[model samples]
Target: MSLFAAETRIVRDQAGRSVRVPANPRRVVALAPSVTEIVFALKQESRLVGATQFSDYPPEADRLPKVGSYIRLDLEKITALGPDLCIAVKDGNPVDVVSRLEMLNIPVYAVDPRSLDTVMAAILSIGDLLNAAEAASSMVADMKGRVSRIRQLASGAKERPGVFFQIGVSPIVSVGTPTFLHELIESAGGRNLAAGDTPYPRFSREQVLALAPEILIITSMARGELFQKVKEEWMGWRELPAVRNRRVHILDSDVLDRPGPRMADGLAQLFDIIHPDLAGKY
Candidate 1:
């Protein structure tokens, strides 16, 4: 048997690729912020030796050895971490980087968590990888319970508001049907005006104004003054129903954007904003 044979086990990742990962990985690297969040959710943070840039949720992740950004990984930094296993996101992590890690005999388990449903699956998969199956199951159950409650509350709503979710400021970007933002909007009893084939579609101010969104939600990575400025800009468009009704709100990009435990929290927040009447009752 090879030197690693006894210490590792073969398992299929979400990408359908079989990986030989350490039975008890003492040194693991997270290739994406979402992956880092999942490891923390499973209480497996101790196993993580490295994490990509912007894995700042839970605060503790910010202290881990940085292996560069998810899109632009630092191979040398990752290698120096001596990670026995690396968890990667299918859509975020560069394929070449994952391939190179595998080539170097570092097992890479790629997880594809596109929506809320798949996020749960990724959590379960990662939990199994880290020998935290019980924790993963508990977390997933909590997420499901929260979602069920939201759906039930949303069903009581008298009307669904048209929501325009702005993620980008320059050139104006909005999410489409395949995105988590769209799912959150729809789940929270709001219609996503940007729903279409394009995952992240660029929108002109005129185009958005024509749609006449009832609720305009802008999620920003920036803080304080910048976000307030963006909100003020939208408020200037008096023709918009969102602006007239004062339904324009700023959302924290981290809570909703990342496919992790906090997604449920984001959904709850969306529900409250989309249906304030029902929110007070809850």
Candidate 2:
């Protein structure tokens, strides 16, 4: 083994690939915003030498050197950062960039955080990598406790509200069975109106109206005014249960969409929206 190989240990990443991560990765690059958030949550931000664009959570991540967006990584900037390790997301980061980074002898550990369980696993795995396993375990335990409480409270509900969650505008798109949003809605005692084989299915206004959702939820991503417009448009249909009951709500997209420490917070917020009668009870 080379001198560098001797100082590193082999570990399997979430993508089922073996990586030779440094024994102590002092300089690391977070290739996705979620990964950056995870690192920060573990209190390992001091080791982060670089982060991707939109890694703005916790506010402090914005100060880190950016290596382009997660989907389109800037190899040159990443190389300039001289990160001994690069934490990537299997779904968001480009595969070619990972391959190229590996070819250049930079250890790239990729994580696949699809659901709440896997997100917790990712945090623990990253914590092990960064020597923060204790912190990770504590965080996971708290998350689990929150989830159990929500589930227990939801179990007492007589009816599961039909929730129409809009994640996109213009064409009107919503999450399907494979997304974490679906899990959140269901766990919060709400039935996802758009659950299907498709990850994100587009819906026409007529189709949405036909579903007759009891609760309408819209996740806003930087388009605050547009979200208000969407809410107003949905409110015009007086026959809709959500409109009649005033159950329409706008949530910050990052809370539900980003698979990180705040997901528990997102679930709690969703529970409040879905089961308002049982909100403070939890």
lDDT of 2 by residue, 1-282 (tens): 457534889999999999999988889999998999999999999999999998999899999999999999999999999889999999988999999999999999999999999999999999999999999999999999999899889988988999999998878999999998899888898999999999999999999999999999998565559889999999999999999999999998888899999999999999999888889777
**How close is each model in CA RMSD to the real structure?**
1.9, 2.0
TM-score of each: 0.96, 0.96
- Top candidate (lDDT): 2
lDDT tens readout by residue for model 1, 41-111:
88889999999889998899999999999999999999999888899988878889888988999899999
Which residue segments of model 2 deviate by more than 4 Å? 1-6
* Alpha-carbon runs more than 4 Å astray in model 1: 1-6, 280-282
Worst 10 residues of 1 by lDDT: 1-10
Residue 271 CA displacement from its true place in model 1, Å: 0.3
Clashing pairs in 1: none
Clashing pairs in 2: none
